[model samples]
Target: MKQYALLVLLTGLLSTTSQGQQALTREPPLVSPEIHDNHSVTFRLKAPTATTATMSGNWMRSEGFARPSATMQKGADGIWSYTTDVLSPEFYTYSFTVDGLRAIDPNNAHVIRDVANVSNALLIDGEFANLYKVNDVPHGSVSRRWYNSPGNTKRRRITIYTPSGYEMGKETYPVLYLMHGIGGDEEAWMGLGRASQILDNLIAQGKAKPMIVVMTNGNVSQDAAPGEGSDGYTKPSFMLPQTMDGKFEETFGDILTFVDNNYRTRKTKAGRAIAGLSMGGYHTAYISQNYPNTFDYMGLFSPALNNKPEDHPQSLAYQKLDLKLKKQMDNGYKLYWVAVGRDDVPILLAGIGDFRKKMDTIGMTYEFKETDGGHTWPNWRKYLTEFAQKIF
Candidate 1:
C-alpha cells in the first residue's frame, strides 16, 4: 500500500510538470526591458485588463521615484508595452505601476535597493557602463570583513575588494577607503555603484592601478547596513546622528590600523586614498582635515559642505580646517579632487562655491569639476572612474 501511494505521488508530480510545459507552449514568456543595439530599451507587462500603466526609473530626466517617465500602451494581446529612445550606457532602476499599484518587474529578476526604495535593474552597455559590466577581463574578489570598532560600541562590517592577482602575489598594494552616503551601508558601492566591476575593468585595461578598495559603512551607530548582519544594530534613521555629531572620526584610526595590519597595504600615507559621496563626502571632508598626514589622496564627490556663517573660514571650525588643509598641502599629496554635478541641489552648489572661494583665498591648489547630471549615482560613478585613474 505504501509503494502504491508513492507511485501515485510520482505520477501527480510528472503530470504537473507536463501541464506546466504545455502551458508554456500555449503562452510564450514575456521578454521585458529588451535592449536594442542602439541602446533603446523596451519594457512590457502582461496586464490585459489594466486601465493604465506607467514606468519610472532613476535614468529618467527627472530624479526620484515618484514621477512616471513613460506611459505604457495596451496591445491586442492584453500586454502593455513601452519603448524608450536611445539611452546612454549605465545601470538604471525602474518599476511599473499598474493602475494605482506600484510593482516590481515580474519578468526581470535583477533588482537594486536604494535606501528604502527597491526597483528592477536595467543595464544598457556602452562606454563607462561597459567598464561597469562584467567583461572578459580578469575579475577581483570581494568579501565581507568584520572588525571591532573602538569608536562605535559594536563590531563593524566592511566590504573589501582585492584585485585579480592579489591572491598569488606577495606585492603590497595601495588602499582606497571608499564610503557611501546617508541611508547606505558597506554594500552600497558594490551593489548600486558596481565598484568591484569598475575596478576590475580599469585594472585590466591598464586605466587604474591595482589597489585594494575598502568600502565601509559610514553610519557610525549601526554595526552594519540593513539586513547585512546578524547584529540587531542595523536600523537606519533620517536624523543621521553619528555623522552629524562628528562621531565617525573618533574611531576611524582603529579601522585604518586594522586594515594596515591585516592587509598587504603600502603602510604609508602616500599609498592611501579616502573618498565618499554626499554624507560620506561630509565625512571625507572632516576625516582628511582632522588627519592631514594620513591620506595623500583625497576625493570629494558632491561633498556636503557646511555653509553656515559659523562654518566659514573666519570661524573657529573653518580656521582649524584651514590649518589642517595647509599642513596636508605642505606635507605633499598626490591629488585633491572635488567634483559635483551642475544640476545638484542649489544649496550644495552654493556650498561648493563657497568652499572653492575659501581654497582660492588660502591659495590651496585643487581640482574642481562640474559634470552633466545632478546628485545621483551616475555622476558619482563617473567621478570614481576619473578619480581612480588619476590616483596612484
Candidate 2:
C-alpha cells in the first residue's frame, strides 16, 4: 500500500514539473507603445508585473509590414511606452494589441470620433493641420462650424480648405469633399492625408487646380456595405440593409449635410465631388454610387471596396441583381478613380477585379490606378496628387 502511494505521488510531481516547463517555454505577446508629443501621438500601457514588452507599427511606410519596436519603454506598473518628438502634422491609425488585447492608447488625450472604429491617435500642428493654416494662405480663410443633425444629435465639427485665392477671386471653385475612413475625423484627410498641402503643392507647380476641398468624416454612410454588418473591414456587399445606416452612419451623415449648408460654393452635382482613403475610399465609392446627384467626381485611394454589390458578400436580394448597386454605373458623375497598391490586400485583389468587371460590363468610364508600394501613404499621397489634378 505504501509503495502504491509513493508511485502516485511521483507521477503527480512529474506532471507538475512538465507543466511548469511548458509555461516557461511560452511567451506573452508584447506591445510597445507609440507616441507623438503634443496631442499628435504617445503611447503608455499600465503593466506593472510584466517582465518584457515591445510594440509593432507600420508607420514608416514599409509596405504595411509591421516594424517591431517602433517605440517602447518599460517600468511604471509594467507600463511600457514610446513617444516621438512632436511629429509632423498628420492623422495616424494605430492600436496596441498588447498581450493580444487590441486597444487604443489610454494615456493619449486626442481622439478621433468614430464608433466601433479601430482606434488611431492624432497629432495636430499649426500648419495644414490647424485651421489657421488656411487663413495664412493668400486667398481664403479656413473655417470650422458645428453642424447639427436631427433627433437632437450633438452637432459635429466640419473643416473646410479653400484656396488662397478663393475669397478674393470671383471664381466658383470646384468642391472636393475628401473623407477619412473608420477611426478618422474631418481633420484626417486635410491634416494627415495632406489634402490641402497636396493641392497647395500641385497648384504651386501648376499641377493641380485651385479648388475648394471639403474634408468630412465618412464613418457611416446612408447605404452601408454588406460586410460592414460585422463592424470591421470586409466585403461591404456582405452587409445587410439592417446593417446599413446604423448609429455610426447617422452621426457621419450629419457632417455631410453640414458641409453642404455652410460651404460657399456650387452645391450641384457637377461642382461637388467626394474622395477618401482606405475605409474612406470605400465610403466615397459607396456614398457616391448611392447618392448620384451629390457628387460630380469620386476618388478612391487604397479603397477597401472589397465586395461589389453581388460578388462575395451576397447577403441581400439586391446582391443578386444589385438593383441597389445601380449607382456603380451612374453616368451622371463626371469622374471616378480607383487606386490601390499591387500588394495592398492580395485578398481583395479578386474583389477589385470583380468590381472592375462589373463596371466594365456596365460600360462605365473610370480611372484605375495600380501603383507601387503596399498599403502605405506613398501610394495614397501619389493617388491624391493625381486625383486632385484630374478632378480640379
Candidate 3:
C-alpha cells in the first residue's frame, strides 16, 4: 500500500450496503482494506495455497481469539476475500496468519517499514473509519510547514494540527510541540496516532482545551546537524545528540526554534509545551532540563531513558538541576508528568522508580502515573488524554 493517506472529512451517514446480511453480519474479508464509507473494511488476499488466516492487533487484544477471525473464499483468479466487522474508525495493525506459519499476505500492498519480514499493515483514513464525522463538530486539519534554521540549510518538516475553531475564532490557544520517536516521521501523530480526531472528540466533549499540536520528525543524523533535516532519511536510533554522539537533543532544539517562529504561537515559554512517546519521551525529559524556559508543562510517556545508569550524562543533568532552574521549575511548571506501563521494562519499572528517586533527591517535582498496558500507542494515546486534561 502507498505510504501517504488521503485526508478527508465526511459529513453524511450512508446506509449499510449489504442486502441479504445485516451490517453486523460477517464482513468482507481481504488482506488490506482501505476505509471506504462506514466503519467497515473489506480485505482480500491472493493466497490460493493457504487454508486458514486471521487478523489481530490492539483494537481487539488478540487474547486467544476474542476477535473472531474472518473466513476467506477463493475467487476466480485464486484471490481470497474476507472482511473485518464494523470496527471503530481508527487505524489498526493486523497480519494474515496462514495455516500454521505466521506470515503476512503477499498480495497485501500495505507494508510496515523497517520490518525484516513482511507486515500486512494498511492505512484507514478517518473518512473510512466513519468516526471522523460522527460528532457533528467540524474536523481539525493539519498542515506541514517549514521554517528557517539558525545555522543549517536542510529544511525539516513540522506537522501542525489546529482545531476546528482556530482560524474562525479569535481565541489563541497554547501550542504543544509534539515529536515522534527514532524511526517515526512527522506522520506518526496523524497516521497511527490519529491525534487530530482524538483532539476533536475531546474538545467537542469539553474534555480537553482546544490547542494546536506540532509534530516533527526527531531522528537526527550525524551528517545532519541541528536546524536541519536528515535529508529525508532516518539515522539509526543510536546516532543522535552529537554531544552524546547519538542521543537526539540538539536536533530537537532546532525543531522547537522553527515551531516558535513560523506559527502565530503563544511564543512565550509559559505558553509552550513539549511531549513525545518512547524516544520522544526521552527527548521531552532531556530538552526540558536543558531548555528550562521553553515549556510550561512537560510530559514524558514511557520515556526511553527510564533507566540510564545514575552516572550517565543524561542522568547527571537530572541530578544536578541547578538552583536557578530548580527554583524556576518549582515556581512555574504547571505539570511534569512521567508515566510508564506496569508491563514495560524497556527501561524497566525499576528504572522509572529510580528516576523518581533521583528527581526527589534533586527536589525536582513531578507526577508519576502507571497503567496496565504495555509500551504501545494505546498507552501513549491514553497518556495524551490524561496529561492533556491537566495542561495549562
Candidate 4:
C-alpha cells in the first residue's frame, strides 16, 4: 500500500513538472553577430522591455583595458540591433548591456570566461586570424592531468597538448612550457590564446614543428583552477597569493618531471622551449635564468619585469639579474625573444626598457618585436604563433 502511494505521488509530481515546462514561454530563434561579405557585422538582441541597449567588444579601440562601446538601436518590433564597420581579421569577444545590465548574446553558443566575466566569442576569419581557427588538419590531443607538487605540498593540475599521432607513433617530440598571466589558469592558453589551434594550423602548414605544449597554473596557493580544485567554485581574482613571489618558478620542476615521465619527450634543452604572457612572462624570465641549462628557447610576451622590494622573501630572484642573464648566455640558448605592445602601460614599457638595458650591458643576443596593441590576448596569441614557428 505504501509503495502504491509513493508511486502515485511521483506520477503527480512528474505530471506537474511536465505541465509547468510546457507552459513556459519559448523565445523565438534569432541569428546574432551575422557576418557580411565585406567583413561588416550585425548583432541582434531581443529585449522588448529594455529601455536602453549598447554593445561592447574587444575589436573596438581600447584605452588601456577599457574598450569603446556602441549604442544599439531599438526597433519598433522590440528587437535591439547594431552594425559595426568593417572589422579586421581577428578573434574578438563581446557582450551586451541591456537596460544597464551586462549580458552575453543569448543566441551565441560560443563563449569564453575571462577570469570572472563571461563574454560571447566571435571569429572573423582572414589574415592572421586564420591561424586561430580550427582548420581541416590532423588535430592534437589536449588533456588535463594532475601531478603532485612537493614544494607546494599538494596535487596540481596541468593542461597538456600532444601533437597529432602522438599515441599511434613511437617518435619523441619537443616540448613547450606555456604559462598564463596573473588571473589565468592552465586553461587560459588553450581557450583564450587558442594555442592548440595555432600549433595545429602552423604544423599543418609546415610553418611549425609538432611538439608537446604544457600549460601550468602559476598560482602556488591553489592546486588547480577555481572550481577544479579542493576549493569549490571560488571566485577568481587578478591579485592572488604567490603569483609573482618566485615559489611557482621554484616548484616548476614537479611539472617537468611529471611530463617527462609520462610523455615521450625529447628530454633535452635543445628540444625544449618556454614562453609566457604578463606575469607568466616574468616567470619565464626567472625560470629560464634560474635553471640556466633547462630551456634553449625563451619567449617573453608583455612580461612584467618590475622589481620587488628588497625585504621580500624571494628578493634574491630579482637580485643579481645581470649575473643570471650572463649565466644563461654563457650556457648558450637558441632564442630569447621579447615582445611587447607599444600601447601597454608606461610602467611595463619602462620595465621592459630597463630589462633590455641590463641585457644590453651583458651583451646578450636576443630578438625583440614591438606590436601595435597593449597587454592583451591577441598580442599573446600572435607571439605564440610566431614563437612556435621559430622554435624546434
Best by lDDT: 4
* Residue pair clashes in candidate 1: none
Candidate 2: tens digits of C-alpha lDDT, residues 1-392: 99999999999999999999999997554443444346435566776665554554445445444434464677655667766555555445555656555566665554442334345554354443442133334343466655665632444456688877666666577788777655555656654465666676567656667778776644333222223223445433323232223233334456556665665677677777788887677667666655656777889887766644444343322233444346545546678888888877675666667777877877788888887667665467667777887874
Please say which candidate is ahead in lDDT: 2 or 3.
3
Q: Candidate 1, which segments miss by more than 4 Å at Cα?
A: 1-26, 63-68, 230-239, 306-319
Pairwise TM-score winner, candidates 2 and 3: 3
**lDDT measured at residue 346 in model 1 versus the true structure, 0 to 100:** 81
* Residue 17 shift from truth in candidate 4, angstroms: 14
Clashes of 3: 18
Stretches > 4 Å off in candidate 4: 1-28, 307-316
Model 3, 238-341: lDDT tens digits are 33443222244545567667765655667777778888887788767777776777788998888777435234545334455455356656656777889888
User: Positional deviation of 176 in candidate 1, in angstroms?
Assistant: 0.4
Question: How does model 1 fare in lDDT?
Answer: 0.84
Q: How many clashes does each candidate structure show, in the order listed?
A: 0, 25, 18, 0
Residue 387, model 1: Cα distance from true site in angstroms: 0.6
Can you rank all candidates by TM-score, best first? 4, 1, 3, 2
Q: Would you give me the overall lDDT of model 4?
A: 0.91
Runs in model 2 lying further than 4 Å from the true structure: 1-65, 68-140, 168-170, 220-257, 307-321, 324-330
TM-score of 3: 0.68
Error of 3 at 35 (Å): 12
Candidate 2 residue 318 Cα shift, in angstroms, is: 7.7
Error of 2 at 118 (Å): 14
